[model samples]
Target: MHIAAQAYGRTSKTGLPTRELEATLLSQSAARLAAARDRRADDFALVVEALEENRKLWSLLVRASSAPESELPDALKQNVAKLGAFIFQKTIDLIENAEPEGFTALAEINRNIAAGLRGIPADA
Candidate 1:
C-alpha cells in the first residue's frame, strides 16, 4: 500500500492541504501571541516577534486575496482587505506601545479566520 501510494504520487507526510496549513499556521501564530502576552513583562521582545510574524502572514493573505486571478468572491476579498488594513494599523500600534492588550484583537481575528478555514460552524 505504501509503495502504491508513493507511486500514485501521494503528498509528503508533512504536507498539509492548503486550508489545513492556513489553520495550523494561524493557530501557531495565535499561540505565539498568547505566549507573548503572558511574558510581556519578562520578555517583551517575544511580543514584537509574534506581532511581526502575524503581520507577515496577513500581508501575504492580503496580497493573495487581492490577486486578479484569485477565485475568492469580491465581497470576501473586500472583507479580507479591510481586515488586512486593520491588522497593519494594529500591528503598528502594538509595535509602538508593546501592550499585551493589543494581542487580543489580533489573536481573535486569526482564530476566527482559522475556524472558518476549518469549516467549523460560526457562532450565531
Candidate 2:
C-alpha cells in the first residue's frame, strides 16, 4: 500500500500548505489509533505502532526546531524542544504502561498542531 501517495491529499505543483506534512502524519496516526482501538481482533502491537509513528514525527520537529539556521524564534524552538523531550519520555512511559488513556493527549497535540498549521489564529 502506498500510504504517502494515497493517505494524505495530493500536493500541488506549487507546494503543500505550511506544516501540511505534519498534519497529514498526525491525521494518519489518529486514524491508526482509532482503528486499533476499534478492532475486535487482537491488536498486539498497536501501541508500539502508534507511538512509534508519533515519536518519529516529534523527533523530526525537534530536529528542525533546534537547527542552528532555523528561522523560528529561540523561545519557540526551546518550547518545541521541551515538548519533544516530554513526548519522548511519554513514549517510553506508554510503552511500559500501555493504555488508551495515554493516546488521547498525543492525538490532541497532533490535532492542535495541525490546526495551527492550517493558519488558524490561536487564542491568546
Candidate 3:
C-alpha cells in the first residue's frame, strides 16, 4: 500500500476520505499483526511481513505529522512522533525476539489510533 499518497483529512484518488482511508489502513495492519502473532508458530514469516507493513505505515504518519506544513498542533505532532519512535523500537525488538506479547501492544496502538481517526472511542 502506497500510504504516502494518502493525505489526511483530504479526499484521495480512490474517492475515499483520507481520514477513513487511514483508519482502514491502520485497522487492517492491526488485524494482520494480530493474526500473524497468533499463527507465528505456524509461519514466523507472516509476523515479520506484518511488522514491516506496520512500520511503513507509522513511518508515513510520523513524517506527515512532523512536516512543517502539517496543520496538527505541536503537542499532537510531538506525541505522534514519540509514538512512532516507540513503534519503530518495538518493531525491532519483536523482529529480534519474536515475542508474541510484543505484537499485542502494536496491534492495540494501531486499533486505538484508527478509532481516534474515526472519531470513535478506542474501547468501542
Query: Best by lDDT, which number?
Result: 3
Give Cα-based local distance difference scores for all models.
0.80, 0.70, 0.87
Candidate 3 lowest-lDDT run of ten: 1-10
Clashes of each: 0, 0, 0
Q: Provide the lDDT at 108 for model 3.
A: 95
Leading candidate by TM-score = 3
Query: lDDT per residue, candidate 1, 9-106, as tens digits?
Result: 33356566766766777787888888887887788689888888888878777887899999999999999999999999999898788776788878
| Residue pairs with clashing backbones, model 1 | none
TM-score of model number 3: 0.89
Q: Which portions of model 2 miss their true places by more than 4 Å?
A: 1-14, 37-41, 121-124
- Per residue, candidate 3 scores C-alpha lDDT tens digits across 25-53 of 89999999999889888888898899998
Full-model lDDT, candidate 3: 0.87
List candidate 1 segments past 4 Å from native: 1-15
TM-score for candidate 1: 0.83
Clashing pairs in 2: none
Report the error of model 3 at residue 13, Å. 1.6
- The sequence of per-residue lDDT tens digits that candidate 2 reaches over residues 1-124 is 3444333345565376537776777677767655654541366487677777778777777887799889999999998999888889878887776666666667767777766777665452
